[model samples]
Target: MNDEHDSAFDSVTSWIVAALGLLVLVLVWGVIFTFTVYSQALGDAFGLSSLRLSSIFSITTAAFYIAGGTIGILIARVPLRPVVATAGAVFGVAIGLLQISSSYLGLAVVFGLLGTAGGTMFVIVISLVPQWFEQYEGRAMGITMAGNGLGIFVLPPVWVWLLERTGIREAFVVVGGATVLVILVAAVVYRRPPELRAQGTAPVDVAWLRSNLTDGRFVSSLVGFALLWSWYFLLSADLVGILTTGGISRAVAATAFGIVGGVSVVARVASGEFADRIGMRVTLAVGTLLAAVGMVVLPWTGTEPLMYVLLVTFGIGLGAIAPLFSPIIIERFGPANATAIVGVFTVAEAATAFLVPIGLNLLLGVTNGYVVPLLTVGGLTLLGAGLFYRGTAPKTSPQL
Candidate 1:
């Protein structure tokens, strides 16, 4: 009876907790989607060359990730909600600055420096739930993780349309205004879980992380994650151009990406729940294989039916990866150091995100097209699948 009672309560709390995390993700990505669109327009307004425009995204992205790692460390030491609120305030200011500044140098400073200031807040939200909830981690993480897609779903079209009507300067003001409202909502509800509250101090278990580094399951997970992210970053930064070159129009490309982003919300949740019911290794391998299939078809997908099929296929895989990755941290590292380990992982992710996109840019610079780049993404994901299979613990090996 007590067990049943505890589980019922746990279920309720978990859903609520996940919902809070999801809300934070939505607003974070909402601002992020809008920011990226606005920055691109700012570059266009000034007649910056393609190389110069890419540089702004490159710098903003690089700084965002490197800072994300540091922000994770900070969250481990501080109250989680305050960090988010502070980040929100800074994000608000960064957007406001764009309203006044129009030069490339000005955009770089505001986005690169001021933008990075509120950067960690979103990272903390994404990272915290994994530590707080363990057993239902995937489902919870998936639901919360969907917040990003939710924003992508709701925000991008709105952004494009708004920018169409209002222009870039006003877009910045609107994006910043939205951030202020959402962050305030998140700040009030995004508290640490009761389990962590019982402990008081943040979890920082060094031994667990050291164990994880040596453990086969954890290592496999890392490799798989690296592959997954490499593909994701590559596509995210280049999708519009890549598909368009294949003969799709810019308007169609935008709509396709918007649909892809929207579909991710459902995909994230389904994959998370599936992982919980089955196991992370099996679920991830299956999801990744499907993602690889989509990659294979992407370059070849020219006709309308095939194009729509590939779009949904690619989204299905991309959406599932994140929720699966985040919620498992506590299982390996424990509550203590969960955030710190995630930070280290973020540092790794940040590096991959920067390099992968930069690498794509270079490939485009040389080849003037995306064939090789798309092929690389598919190949890496398959390679990662093999690496993951080999890295799993032997049935005889003791579990970490």
Candidate 2:
């Protein structure tokens, strides 16, 4: 009877963690990615150039992962509730600061704050879900990450409506406040499992990471992540711009972008479940390959219908790839090493987020087309797929 009761309680708590994790990703990643929708509005308001506009996103993204990886070290050793709550407070306030900033530098600084806090919250939320379940870990991670897809899908249209009605300033104020409130509530409710809470682990150190470097699997995963994220950010930084420039209406382009996110919602759950059956290595590789194929063909698609179809393909890969990061890491390194290991991958992600967009945008300026840069994205992502397959643990490996 006691065993049954414990099992029931664990089931309830696990789903709760999944639910909150979903909510957090919706707001955090959703708000961040919605920059694409608002980039035009921001540019119009500030008289900014494309390079300058991309820089704002680059700054935020780079800061986000860099902070996630750096601060994640500290978080591994400390109590989580206070740190996450403080991060929530900081994220909401920084977003609110966007309303008053008129200058490029000011906006960059403020967004850097948003990225830092959001990154912290994001990593924490992602880290927590896996601790709750062993059997459905992939699915849980997928479900949680689907919030990102949902947010991207849902928020753009909402932001469009809000921007039209209230303008960007008021939108920021309302949305920022709401984000703060939700994160605070989640922080209060989301706790580590008792088993995890009871473990008194030491902070991860450089020497330990150095030793892990000797493992080819670990290094391969890191390299694959960096390359994969480079491809992702390359597209993200300019997909809307590509559509608009291709003679598609802004509304249509936004819809296409949302299509990617919407499809990703399904892909996230499906890929997670599929990974459980066939193995995450195969799932990861196939997803990346699909995205690559879509990306390679995207520059050739002149019509709206084809663009939408290709984006759906890309979305599946996007959804599948993002959720596997933690699962793969935890599988190889163990849960105790999960947070710190993820932080290292976050650093790789940060490098790509910071540099890839800027580089691609610059390449676009030189080439006067998306052809070369996008082709580069496709090729690199294919390489990423191979690397992930090389690095990921096979299904036959003993479960941690």
- With a 3 Å backbone cut-off (N, CA, C), the pairs that clash in candidate 2 are none
Clash list (residue pairs), candidate 1: 203-336, 203-337, 204-336, 204-337, 205-336, 205-337
lDDT of each: 0.69, 0.78
Native-to-model Cα distance after best TM-score fit, residue 98 in candidate 1, in Å: 3.1
Model 2, 1-400: lDDT tens per residue?
A: 1334334323777887788888888887767868888888888887799999988987887778898777875677667788879988888668767777889988888889888888888888777777777778888888989988888777777788888987777777776777788789877767666666667565677777777788787788788888876667776667778777777788788667667778889999998899878877678788888888887887777788888788888888887888877777767666665567777778878777778877897888899998898898888888877776667766466433
Which residue runs of candidate 1 sit more than 4 Å off their true CA positions? 1-14, 39-41, 44-52, 113-118, 160-170, 197-220, 240-254, 358-373, 386-400
In candidate 1, position 171 carries an lDDT of 75
Residues 1-400 of candidate 1 have per-residue lDDT tens digits of 1334323323555565567667766766776555556666777776777788877766776666778666675567577678667777877778777778868888777677543653575566666666655567777777888988887667777788888898777876776677676676667656656556557664445764577679777677567666666777777777777777788778778677667777778898898888878986667777778778777777765666777888787778777776766555445445554556566667778767768877888887898767777888888888876665455534455654
What's the C-alpha lDDT at position 72 in model 1? 74
lDDT of 1 at 206: 70
